[model samples]
Target: MTHDAHSALLHAALDAAERGWHVFPLRPGTKRPALHGEQRCPGTGPCASGHRKWEQRATTDPDRIRATWARAPFNVGIATGPSGLLVVDLDVPKDHSSSDTPDGATTFAALCERAGHAVPATYRTRTASGGEHLYFTAPPGVRLANTARTVAASVDTRAWGGYVVAAGSTTSTGPYEALCGPEAVAVPGWLLSILRPAPKVSEAPSVATMGQSRRYADVALAREAQTVAGAVHGGREAALFRAARALGRFVAWGDLSRHMVEQALQEAGEAAGLTVAECRSTLRSALNWSIAHNQRRRTA
Candidate 1:
């Protein structure tokens, strides 16, 4: 990297730290972890901690950031989950030319269409290889696991257990450029459902312990309903459907009564401006869908 590029990266790292984002160093011009050794690293594989365990050692301490970046112009890696952030990485194929139509762009557009909502305006970064990273504040409760090509081919998630190369980090192709700087937005309900599916039902707890367990379960289910309630917008019906479906899971597990779940959905939907008819229709559809979904899981 050039002296100018090095300065740009260091400045970017500091800025991220100031924003309370946990930042770590990647090997200069590469995505590998800057730290390496037999002891400091832990793992059994070649690309594990011994060489590129970047995610494990990522930190936000200013002193550590300053010391690491000063020794060499290292690329910046942001610890995603630790920072309460999630990133969608839309990537172009490595063999593709920079000017080619980006796969990420095409798939993301399709994703927006399917969700019945436009992408929320927030912080975005243009990657060195002509891809993009859409940043969002991670939702509570669900463990958004990192996955590759799950949303679409070439589209991946850097969730709670992953890291993303920060904007301004330099690579062989070029620097990761910040395209937008707004606060990270919430992940839409449609997107969230795809990233983290509704939990499956489990065997019922003993009847002897039902009283205490039911109280705890009700509180948990109520919180999940609130998560759904937040999904009120252009896709209000779809969002409610997701919420109702989640509630249905509790019913299936015998932790919540169907009447209780329906009451919760009705109240939340009405408060969110949904009509009585719409809420009922959504609830019925969600229950049916949940039943079918569970059947498929059981058979499979």
Candidate 2:
């Protein structure tokens, strides 16, 4: 693609980013200039030659840029938001067949069933080489990596001769499937059933008694939160970022009230390898105790 066309695509992507869409980068192999969707560039890193292309596209043709954004296969609202940019591979071989599905519709239905949601028909797309991209709306408040992993896990795309081309990853040219569309799909009943809420577990009380127990619980919960956040976010920095967000939300509602503590305990239990139901029951008991103590304090 020419510099002008590349700029156009970048501007469109930037606009999409501003609108809450994640602008995933693409490239052929590890070599060649990077491309955001159809927009190709020569930059490297975050502000690489590609970044310059996007900037130029934004400046030279603002209206056309907006139009491109509107029509982009992957719509990212704006260039700035909590969501970060990702670079993914888009090439899949046509002759590559998987045992999962014979055609796009079946693939779409199967993936949706596995993801525990209903996907929009619009999310399905035919690649240049006759492959398909089956887009599905991600769950709200879930990390992108988790969402991606969950989707990947749910579908046997490989058996059907399709595979998820990870963003920033390499691939061989064939038919490609890129899921992209707007619409929030609810979590399906089967998945919801499998993912039962965490249950509570019993812990031996400390010899130091009351204050020590509370402190111990707090420290343990905090550590567990960090671990869950790490796994969900996929890196130390990203994990910390998620933890800060969760902490802020928790504090905003009130600093770990008995009810909050119980909820945290349930989450902590899950993070610590307990079943959701087990964590819930254990935390419920703890919360009841804490509530009784609070009530007594009020009466006194």
Candidate 3:
């Protein structure tokens, strides 16, 4: 990164802090949290209490920002939940395939049209890759779940428990640029309604509870596959690793089949705009890792 880019990042992080967004340092030229060695957890599982928790470490405190950025020019990452914000990540691939869906912005516009809601003209950022990030104020008392392509095949949401690269963060392609001032508007009610997970229906008193439980699990598994299909922005390999781990847990419990998961990943990856070669390699590696982890846990 250049001197200008480094200065831009620091200024952007300060701007985000001024907007009440909790900011954290991402590695220069990468999106990964900048914690190292004992401070960082390098696996799919939960971190130890004292380790550097990415979300917990994120802060809006100006002193912390100065201290962290003084060491190195780190990319700025905004914690969505802590900031009471939600982000709609939109991506448009450089190359189109026979099966590619509409670009993220187009898909998002269509979703809003269908729901009879207007897209908020709030804080917006242009991504490093030719994509966009739309920001909104999160609703009170509602914890929105992050989803990939829940609305359209190219759109994704970063909600509670998620973070986004803030405007001015430098990626390999270039620095993220703001499309508007750092002001966020409330999330649309229709959008909030869609974000909520539907409540499970009660099983009939006369029906077998075992059968109902199995049905619910099947529905959840299908939903998980959908999330993987729509995921973009998050590193492709990391996303695959997480999706595979979730599926593998169900397979270990005998609630799902390994073959089913492999096939589902293939389809989800394609829908998410990942190349076939990348998808296959990621799945093979992730599945092996997940299965071994499961076996070790069971034996332990």
TM-score: which candidate is best?
3
1 against 2, candidate with superior TM-score: 1
Winner on TM-score between 2 and 3 is 3
- Runs of candidate 3 with Cα error greater than 4 angstroms are 1-3, 37-49, 97-100, 200-300
Please identify which of the two predictions, 2 or 3, would achieve the higher lDDT against the true structure: 3
Residue-level lDDT of model 1, residues 142-170, one tens digit each, is 67878776455687899777888888887
- Stretch of 10 with least lDDT, candidate 3: 199-208
Error of 2 at 4 (Å): 5.9
Summing lDDT over every window of 10 consecutive residues in candidate 2, give the lowest-scoring window. 154-163
Ranking by TM-score: 3, 1, 2
lDDT of each: 0.74, 0.36, 0.73
Superposed by TM-score, candidate 2 places the C-alpha of residue 9 at a distance from the truth, in angstroms, of 2.6
Q: Can you write out model 3's per-residue Cα lDDT over 1-300, one digit (the tens) per residue?
A: 577767878888899999999999999887888865453466433344455577777889888898888889999999998888989899885567744567888877865654455677888999988799999998788788787755446778998789999887877887688998458898776566446654323332334355654565477568767887776543343455567765665565565678888888888887887778767766775566556546521211
What TM-score goes with each of the models?
A: 0.62, 0.32, 0.64
Q: Write the per-residue lDDT of candidate 2 for residues 47-133, one digit (tens) a residue.
A: 454355321222223454455434433211221112322211122333466664244445435434433355444434344444454
Error of 3 at 137 (Å): 1.1
Q: Looking at model 1, which ten-residue stretch has the lowest summed lDDT?
A: 291-300
Q: Model 3 Cα displacement at 28 (Å)? A: 0.9
